[model samples]
Target: MDGGVLEDEVNRARLVHAAGLVAPDDAQLAGALSASDDAIAEAGRQRRILAATLGNAVNVLNPSMIVLGGFLGSLRDVDRDAFDDEVRARALAASAENLELASAALGADRLLIGAADAAMQRLLADPLG
Candidate 1:
């Protein structure tokens, strides 16, 4: 609907609490993914929520692959197996069977690179554009 609840669950404030970070951005996530006990527990909880959300999407769309970029890739990288297990548990068997979760090949710069590629393609197609 309005994304109010999802936004509440997946924002910097809770992440800050989870990771015990002062910066309240990437540090929040990094801290959660750290090797500390608090990190393990918090990271696991976050991953479960993320996986359940993905599983709900899979049930609706049955997509073959889900590509994550930016911080999302880092989130998945923290505990891929655990995330996969959570998704499998929540997703329909048929939908989860062929699903693949992957990270962007271009890392964090993929959007800029894609924009440049699009511009080049357009320029080559019409040199005056």
Candidate 2:
């Protein structure tokens, strides 16, 4: 539960299959490097994990849509479908109906961009706006 340990875990997860070092201070560049270096395979792995996990969830609750963000969106079609199939096979039959998965329309910075949008929305909704 130490802060350093938690941060290390985060970094390790981020860079588990990374081809190079990825540090917190260099996360932005690391994100880019990740996208350029192993985005496809990594994304496929993630998708497969998600699919299998969701498929195995008790009672089944497959997401109607899956939005691949971060470095994952850049993956090619073949990898995408493979991941989709992995998830579909595990997903509940009814839950898998009409399921859709696609890369984020925004690029690598979608998370940051989304945070900005959320902040702006929260501010605009505030009485001070």
Candidate 3:
């Protein structure tokens, strides 16, 4: 509700009341992995979101493989099985069949590489401009 915005005091208060956190940092969120049921539920929510997004992508792009980069790629380190299961369940059989999901192999350099690649693509598409 309210677009999940935490801008207002009421929303932030509600989030704090519900999750017992006021803007948890990455380390805090990561620590939650083994600390509480809420974290598990949040992880599940993330998996579902990923599943839906990837499912749509599969239907549209029909990519044989998908590389999860950036923060998304880090899910492999958190709970690979759950992520895989969610994707398998949500994506169409034809779309998911033979689909491969791999974490970015570029490690910390992925963001830089991705940015450079995007820039190159844009340049190539308008070489004269």
Candidate 4:
């Protein structure tokens, strides 16, 4: 999954949450980031919610490998563990076989790196090679 969440502060103590899914072709994952305390808290809350949603989605997909990318892709172990647990909870037993969950290899630059890598790979695979 590729996306980003940004929180915004509407007032001194109030905040607004804005986030969305990002497509591979999207140039930027721009959004609002809250400075307010509540907004910050809301961002955290939304992060967890997103983690759970991702876990559930992965469970549903049950792919052999699951790669998490985006702003929060580099979350700490605890956060990653929480996401994994949620994914497992929602996934079926058979689907969990050899499941690999890890941070995105490209970190925050995955999209750019992936594009370059693809280009290089294609170039290498060309008949001209």
Best-fitting candidate, measured by lDDT?
A: 1
Task: Tell me the TM-score of model 3.
Answer: 0.57
Residue pairs clashing in model 4 are 7-33, 7-34
Structural RMSD, model 3: 6.4
Which stretches of candidate 4 lie above 4 Å from their native place? 1-40, 75-78, 127-129
User: What pairs collide in candidate 3?
Assistant: none
Model 4 over residues 12-97: C-alpha lDDT tens digits? 12222232333422122213233345434654565566556655666677688777555444332325676676566666767765
Q: Which regions of candidate 2 deviate over 4 angstroms?
A: 1-18, 21-48, 57-59, 71-78, 127-129
Predicted structure 4: clash tally? 2
Error of 1 at 8 (Å): 2.6
Query: By TM-score, how accurate is candidate 1?
Result: 0.74
Could you give candidate 2's per-residue lDDT for residues 12-88 as a string of tens digits?
A: 35544453444432334334434645643544454454555545652255568877554444432335677667666
Please provide TM-scores, in order, for all candidate models, with all chains considered together.
0.74, 0.56, 0.57, 0.52
Candidate 1 lDDT at 20 equals 64
What is the Cα-based lDDT of residue 44 in candidate 1?
63
Per-residue lDDT value at 105 in model 2: 73
Question: For residues 1-129, what per-residue lDDT tens digits would candidate 3 score against the true structure?
Answer: 235422232222332234456666434544554456765555555555666667778878888998876446544447777677677667788888888888778866766898999999999999998
Output the worst ten-in-a-row residue range by lDDT, candidate 4: 8-17
lDDT of each: 0.72, 0.54, 0.62, 0.52
Q: Which stretches of candidate 1 lie over 4 Å from their true place?
A: 1-4, 12-32, 35-38
Q: Give every collision pair in model 1.
A: none
52: Cα error in model 1, Å: 0.6
